[model samples]
Target: MNISYKWLKEYVDFELSPQEVCEALTSEGLEVGSLEEHQAIKGGLRGLVIGKVETCEAHPNSDHLHVCTVDLGQGELQQIVCGAPNVAAGQKVVVATVGCKLYDGDKEFVIKKSKLRGVESNGMICAEDEIGVGTDHSGIIVLPESAKVGMPAAEYYHVESDYLIEVDITPNRSDACSHYGVARDLYAWLVRHGMKTSLHRPGCEAFKVDNHDLDIAVEVEDNKKCPRYCAVTLKGCEVKESPAWLQERLQIIGLRPINNIVDITNYIMFAYGQPLHCFDADMIKGNKVIVKSLPDGTPFVTLDGVEHKLSHEDIVICNEEEPMCIAGVFGGKGSGTYENTTNVLFESAYFNPTSIRKSARRHGLNTDASFRFERGIDPNGQIYALKQAAILARELAGGTVSMEIK
Candidate 1:
């Protein structure tokens, strides 16, 4: 599990540095396997900053290239050559000047003064995928106008200098799979050891349900396999990119932020140690969910577009007509929330760890949700986790909340 140093601060305001925190975590039995600093990778990323395009004109020598003057707030404008189609004047973009080290996903290189197509190129422009911050390479990264010029891109984005701490969780210690769980342990250790620290301790957070007059229908055919199942109905939910804070939190922890609806479920999983799944309300047949074991040779496709055949030993989350989820494993492809998703059925459940482990290996699907389910989770926390995810869904995606599980 990779835990972000900055993210742990949200739960406990620890005054220790990131390295110190890693040491403290080890003492708490959350043994750290390896600690990596983002900026410390391959020396560092210096001279990377938010720059405003001052002027841009088509290159007389190259059709695809443009010459521009960028204002990096260094008291003088710098000349640069860019080939991104979306590069334009008055836009704030990422600038990697001479002496800066950059990674292009395939190789690491140093930015130096160079000439391209007869133009004196002093630096290089950046795209999201170019530096591996995201998968979008449609054009150069355009920062918001509120982005301050001359600010280091690392400081501006709050990443590029973060730390990634890798830890090993024993099968018996499934609770430490989440950052919150690890921090919770650390806090307890500090208190038991009588260590004094300036960090503000964030106690347990309560989930409140406002709208309760909802009609959500679900049935569990095999209670022995699935211990607890909880869900919340979100009406009129809009799917869109998550807010900057949410996206940054996920990205820093090596998770690709999808849409707001899906990100909320992922956030809850990492924060509360419960894996939640989001199903498009319309895709669920009869607006009902059923948890059961299927017969042998039952075919299904996962959200990642992979097909699998299930046996009687496998548990599934199905609607009245078809499988909506593979129980605690991967979810069905068609039932996932997407850009067109309006109504969402958010689900959080605890399954028999042994059953989930067996099914996961048989189906050859190893996912984050499955990893947690196979190790066990706090079944009693299902309702709290579901309602918390719903609140975030309503706030981030503009939805109406309705508690679905009793």
Candidate 2:
């Protein structure tokens, strides 16, 4: 389990350093494999700041290069040569000033005064991947306009040297597999040690989601394998880039930001410790889902585009026409959402632990959902998680809840 210090802050307001938290968790039975601070890489990010592109023009000597003058809120504007195709005037970007060192994996890169095809560059403009915050190396990371030009890039990008605690959770410790689970346990340990806590306990137990009465169908063929399955149907939802706050939450946790439809599911799972999957409603054949056991040798394509042959014991969530997902595992490609998808259906359920575990191992596909399911989750609490996803879908994706499925 990789738990981010910043993510834990969202749940608990403890001022303990990452190392301290790791120590506390270790003392409480959760083994910490290692603790690493983001700043430790590349000897730390210093002399990097949020910058505004004052002007951007094509390089005279190279067609693919752009000469950019950036305002760092200082007396002099710094010139940078950028090869990103997205650089534009009036954009907020990362400016790695001279003498700053950035790392890509173990390789060290130093920003300095140099000429890029005859253009004298004072510093280097950076992307998320360039500085290690994310994998988006397509272009320079554009900060929100509210970012102060002179703010430290680490602060602006939230690199605050946050630590990721790599924990070794035993399979029997299913509840501690997620960040919230870890926080909850750590909070307990803190209280037991006579430390004060401002942490709100994980609230999904009584979490309320407004019911939108519409129409959907769900059938669990084997009640023993799938105790309960809930699907939240949405209509008129707009799948677009998530707002900055939502995107930041996922990005800081090292999850790639997709469209709002996908990101919301990821965010809810990231925060609530309940794994959820969203399917494009329009793509769901007959607007009905059936949770059942498929025949052995059934071929199905998961969202990753990998075709897996199903065993007779495999549990699947099928639409009227075909299997939409390997229950408590991954979604199928046929019903996945895309940018143009306006309606969606999110599934939250509890699957038999041993059943999911064997199926996951049989197919050589272990996912976050499978891991949690195989270890067992709060079966009675899944409806609440389903509703939370419903509420978020309405708020973030401009969707109206159409119905509840069981």
The per-model lDDT (C-alpha) reads 0.82, 0.81
Residue 261 of model 2 has an lDDT of 84
Q: Which candidate has the highest lDDT of all?
A: 1
TM-score of each: 0.74, 0.74
lDDT of 1 by residue, 1-406 (tens): 9888777867765567777888888888888888877652333446688899999999989989999999999999999999999999999999998988888655778899998988899998899876656789889999899999999877776554678888888898898888778888777767777776433433325345557545578888999998788777878888999997898778877899999988988888887789999998878888678899888888889888888988898889998898867888888889899889998888888899999999999888899999999999887878777777876877888888765464
lDDT of 2 by residue, 1-406 (tens): 7777877877776768788999988988899999876543345568888899999999999989999999998979989999998999999988899999877677887787999898899998888878877788889888888889889876665555667888898877877777777888888887887887867634433323345654677778899998888887888888899997787667656788989888877776767668888888887778678889888899999889999999889899888878888888778887778988987888888889999999898888888788888888877767767777777778788788777445
Give the local distance difference test score of model 2.
Answer: 0.81
Off by over 4 Å in 1: 39-45, 48-160, 197-214
Error of model 1, residue 20, in angstroms: 2.1
Candidate 1 Cα lDDT to native: 0.82
